[model samples]
Target: MTSLTLAGIRKRFGKVDVIRGVDLRVADGEFVVFVGPSGCGKSTLLRMIAGLEDISEGELRIGDRIVNEVQPAKRGVAMVFQSYALYPHLTVRDNMGFGLKVRGVPPHERRQRVEAAAATLKLDALLQRFPRELSGGQRQRVAIGRAIVGEPDVFLFDEPLSNLDAELRVHMRSEIASLHKRLGNTMIYVTHDQIEAMTLADKIVVLRDGQVEQVGTPRQLYERPGNLFVAQFIGSPKMNILPIEAVAGKLPGQPKTASLVGVRPEDLELTEPGSGFVDARILISEYTGASSLLHVQLPSGQVFLVAHDGEAPPADTSVGLAVEPGRLHFFADSGRRAD
Candidate 1:
């Protein structure tokens, strides 16, 4: 295993700069993920690390060696792409051994390595199957196995589970998490899916337009987001934001005139008709399997969401809502959290 570091990494195409001055340190054997919207320069950063794209300006180090100009193969990094990239004509065994073969490893050693990886990935039963004969999940396992056989110091996954169905995606996610735990190699995953990042990453690096937005653990980002963008982006069903005047008179302690206040759906509770801050007319009630989401319209003509019990009040019913003081997040005029 090895640690990877990027200092002032930048990339540009003519006049448009895609990645601007990013500095990150990935500790040895840590599972880190990069997450952002499309065209946010995440893939570009990954490519730069893989040596597939040249660094416009910066330094990259792997295991104490400055590898800015080193070739991709000598960097001891293996990348698993979104498409699986398995050879159509090659069987699983052959595909796993292909890299070693090209590198001129002895035949007996290549066979041993492939067999070991196949056993680890549970692909031993499908060794003779070609790509066309395998399911999507199986094909992805093969791709991972190919990288495993290389015994790379760092493993890079570029949205490797994006091609699978929902059920298979969940299954592959568990498999990948297990693989990381078992191998304990340095892993860097890039994905736009927030759930994947939350579940897989020991640390998440959130990026936007080539800039680092925030870097934190899943709980930290979910509970104490630094800005409006991160607060809205990191949670499921999103946090409900309302103008400060809507609840300004209801909350305890002076709020120093914040521009906006964020309340998560789970943070608001449904109470008796005369109980708390405001009376809301239920605009809509959606019943998910485990919880019912209530869309409540406040007196100021603003709508907010609240999560209620699975068996919640009917639509158009009048309800009272109360929020815990500690649960409210305050943002200033600049959209950053007020310290």
Candidate 2:
């Protein structure tokens, strides 16, 4: 296992800067995930760490060595990409042992390593099958097994589950989590899916337009986001942002510089009409088996979502929305959180 450090990392495509001055420290055996929307540079940063892209400036260290100039194969890291990238003509055993074969490892040792990895990935039964004969999940496991045989210090994944179906993705997520637990190797995963980040990471790194938005545990980012972008991006149904005046008198010790207040969908509760701080008319009530998402439009024309259990009120019905003062998140004019 190895720890990774990025100091003032920057990446540029000619005159355009894609990754700007990122600094991070990943501890040994840590499962760290990078999450962001498309074009946010999450993948670019991962590529840099994998030595697949040139770092315009900054230092990258893996363990105790400075690996900024090292070749990908010598960097002590293995990368699993979105595509399985398996050879159609090669059997599972050959594919898993290909790296070892190329490095001139002895035949007996290669067999032992390949068999061990196959057993670990539950691919022992498929060793004689070709890539075309395996299912999507099986193929992915082969790709991961190939990496495992290399005995890399760190494992890097770039949306490795994106191509799988929804059900398969969930299954693979658990498989990867279990693999991490068993291997205890440092892992860096890049994904646009927050759910994946939330479910699999020991720590989460949120990025936006080549900059680090925030870095914390999944619960930290969800329960106490550092800024408006994080508050809106981390949660499902997203946090609703309203002008401060909407709940000006309802909150205690409201900061004078607060321009926007945020309340998560789950934090907003339905109350008796005229009994809560904000009054709104229900625009739509979307019933999702376990809970209903109520889209309510405030008098100021802004729509907010509230998660409700049991039956929902009919559309066009006026209702009151209440939120605990402690649950409200305040943001300054610049979008940074305000105390």
Candidate 3:
């Protein structure tokens, strides 16, 4: 395993800069995830680390070596791409061992490595099967196995689960997470899926428009976002942003500079009409098994979502909602977090 360092990393295409200066550190054996919307340059940055894309200006170090100019193969890194990228004609065993063969590993050693990786991924039963013969999840496992046989110091995954069905994605996610715990290899994953990032990463680097937005653990990002963008991006059903006046008298010790207040869907609880922090009319109620999501509209015409347990009140029902003062997140007009 190895640590990775990016100091002032940058990538540009003519006049358009795809990756602005970015500095990050990944300690040995850490699972770091890069998450953002499409075209935010997460994948570009990952490719730069893989040496597939040239750094416009910056230093990249894998462990202690200045690897800015090191070739991808020589960087001791293996990449599992968004696509399965498995050779259809090759059997599972052959596909996993292909890299070793190309590097001229003796046939006996290559066989040992292939068998080991297959065993690790539970692909031994399908070693002789072709890519066309396996399910999507199996193919992805083959792709990961291919990288594992390389015994890379760093493993780079570029949205490796986006191709699978929702159920399969969840299963593969567990597989990958278990793999990380068992092998303890240094891993860097890039995905636009925040839920995926939350589940797998020890640290998440949130990016936006080629710039670093926030870097924190899943709980830190969700509970104490550094900015409005991160506040809205990290959670499902998003955060409800309301002008401070909406709950002016309801909160105590609110910063005078705060222009906006953010309340997470799960934090708001429905109460008797006119009895809580604010009053609203329930516009819609969506039952999602354990919890029902209530879409309530304030008198000001703004809608907020509340994740409520128990039976959902009917639509257009008058209700009051309250969130603990500690759970409310305040932001300035500039959208930066405010105390």
Look at candidate 2 and give me any clashing residue pairs.
none
- Compared with the true structure, model 1 gives a TM-score of 0.97
| TM-score for each predicted model, relative to the true structure | 0.97, 0.98, 0.99
Give the 10-residue window scoring lowest on summed lDDT in candidate 1.
246-255
**Candidate 3 lDDT by residue in tens digits, 1-339:** 999999999998998999999999999999999999999999999999999999999999999999999999999999999999989999999999999999999999999999998999999999999999999999999999999999999999999999999999999999999999999999999999999999999999999999999999999999999999999999998999999997778887689999999999999988898888889999999999999999999989999999999999999899998888899899999999997
lDDT of 3: 0.95
Ranking of predictions according to TM-score: 3, 2, 1
Instruction: Kindly list the per-residue Cα lDDT of model 1 for residues 1-339, writing each as its tens digit.
Output: 999999999999998899989999999999999998999999999999999999999899999999989999999999999998999999999999999999999999999999999998999999999999999999999999999999999999999999889999999999999999999999999999999999999999999999888999999999899999999889877898877777667765536957788889988998877687778989999989799988999989889889887688888899898888889888888989874
lDDT of each: 0.91, 0.95, 0.95
Report the error of model 2 at residue 216, Å: 0.5
Runs of candidate 3 with Cα error greater than 4 angstroms are: none
Per-candidate Cα RMSD to the true structure, in Å, reads 1.3, 0.9, 0.8
Error of 2 at 261 (Å): 0.5
